[model samples]
Target: MLSRSSFLAVIATIAATNVVAAPFTYVNERFGTVCTFPDDIFTDRQPEPDNGDGQQWLSADGASLICSGILNIDDDTPKGFVAAEKASSEPGYKVTYSKASKDWAVLSGLKDGNIFYERRLFGRDGVIRTVWIEYPPAAKSKYDPLVGAIAGSLKAR
Candidate 1:
């Protein structure tokens, strides 16, 4: 029941639809919102792997940096992680990685993407329990400092 032009126009529009890049949300709560981060602006990078380096994305404000490092649990530990932390109600190592944490909220895909492992720790009113989304160095070119900062600034509500 549609005209040829109308159908073509619809098809064209569909073809041209480019999904906007949404911000990657890692964590959010009464504490704060953590997302994809911006890197330090003062630093320089390799455009094409100069000296074996690679390219990276800069943050809008540019102070802290997010760089991908190798994903190795054997040789890595969570930053600012506390030996004793808390969750809804369980006795674990403070914070533990579970794709099914009620705390993650809608920050989905934290376990399905380049995030290799999630390091967890607990926080309280005036303390910090940091977590990490480990990825390879190649992915380091796309570090999410907002996410890191969120992990760095978490506390129990």
Candidate 2:
């Protein structure tokens, strides 16, 4: 038989596990994409009009942002991403990762003392999905993984 203290410890562990927040999947069927994000970071989400394609999430402190949207284009997915890149208005934009054939690209740069990371993916359905994550440069280590998760979660239907 287990000791009383041992049983209490096991109960505590189970309770802790239950306290952990579960992740949520945000799906936009109109754009044919799904994104998953942890429930801990962003505390508020509001629907925004993106010409019928968009969503936004705000961090608890409101210091960070995550947003996604879609744009209609006639070009193929790859070309659509390329065209979007060429049309970027960010001065001194630097591409951190890019794959034209994959129809995905990640670009980052410092703007107004804040680090801006943008991941863009073009779908075969003539819709382009873009995820933008902005946070202070000093918090890169903390936010980078979150950015990766949100971007990777995006899947075309």
Q: Which candidate wins on lDDT?
A: 2
lDDT tens digits, residues 1-157, model 1?
A: 3334533443343333331232222233323323232223313332533332112343332322222222233432233122222222342222334332312211212222334334333222322223344443344443433333333332232
Off by over 4 Å in 2: 1-21, 63-67, 74-99
Q: Rate the local accuracy (lDDT) of all candidates.
A: 0.31, 0.60
Highest TM-score against the true fold, candidate: 2
Clashing pairs in 1: 37-146, 68-140, 85-94
Where model 1 places Cα greater than 4 Å from the true spot, the runs are 1-130, 144-147
Instruction: State every prediction's TM-score relative to the real structure.
Output: 0.23, 0.67
Clash-forming residue pairs, model 2: none
Clashes of 2: 0
**Model 1 reaches what TM-score against the true structure?**
0.23
lDDT of 2 by residue, 67-120 (tens): 455665455566566566766787756444445557676666665666767776
